[model samples]
Target: MKIGELSRTTGVSIRSLRYYEQQGLITSVRQPNGYREYTLLTIETVETVKLYLNLGLTTEQIASFLTCVLQNKEAFCTEVMPVYRKKLAEIERQIVELNQIKANLIDRIAFLGQQEQGNDE
Candidate 1:
C-alpha cells in the first residue's frame, strides 16, 4: 500500500505519517523508480504507534519499547509494566490538581453570585 492508504486506514494525517518516517518511528523502502514502498505490516505498526503515542509515550520511548519487544518479548512485557504504572501515577496527580482547580472555580462563581444578589438588596 501507499502512504495515502496508510493515512486513510490509520486515520492519521499524511503529514503525521511523513513526520513519523522522519522521526524514525516508521520506515519505508524505496524502489528503483524512487517510490516508497510499504509493507502490509505497516498498517499494524502505525496502529501500534498511535496507541503508544496516545498513552503519552514519546517517539524515543516508543522506539525503546519496540526494540525491547523485538529483542525479548517476555522481559519486555514484564519490565515495561512499571513505566506505564508511573505514567498512570502522574496522570492521577494531574487529575487531583485539575479537580482542585475546578472546585476553586465553583467557589468563585458562588461568591460572585452572592455579591450580585447583595447589590440587588
Candidate 2:
C-alpha cells in the first residue's frame, strides 16, 4: 500500500507517519514516482508506535523498542525491560508529586472554608 493507504488504515495523519519515518520508528520504500510504498505490516507498526507514544514513551524510546522487536520478538522482553522499568519509575515519581499537589489543594480549600465560617460567626 501507499503512504495514504497506510495512514488511513492506521488512522494516523500523513504528517505523523512522515515524522515517524523520519524518527526511524517506521520505514517505507520509495517508488520510482517518488511515492512511499508501505508494507501491510506498517499498519501494526504504526499502531504500536501510537501505543508507545500514549504510554509516555518518546520517539527515541519507541525506536529502541521497535528495533528490538523487529530484530527478534523473543528478545524484546529482555531488551526492553530496563526501559520499561525506568519509565515506570518516572511515572511513579510524577504520581507522588501529583498526590502532594492534590493534598495541598485540599488543605487550601479547607482553610478557605474555615475562614469563611469564621467570618460568618
Best-matching candidate per lDDT: 2
Per-residue lDDT tens digits for candidate 1, residues 1-107, read 78888888899998988888887777899889876778887787788788888999777767757645545663646657876787889899999999999999999
Estimate the Cα RMSD of every predicted model relative to the unseen true structure: 2.3, 1.7
* lDDT scores in order: 0.81, 0.87
Model 1 bad stretches (over 4 Å): 69-76
Error of 1 at 47 (Å): 0.8
lDDT of 1: 0.81
How far off is residue 76 in model 1, in Å? Answer: 4.7
Clashes of each: 0, 0
TM-score of 1: 0.83
Cα displacement (Å) at residue 34, model 1: 3.6
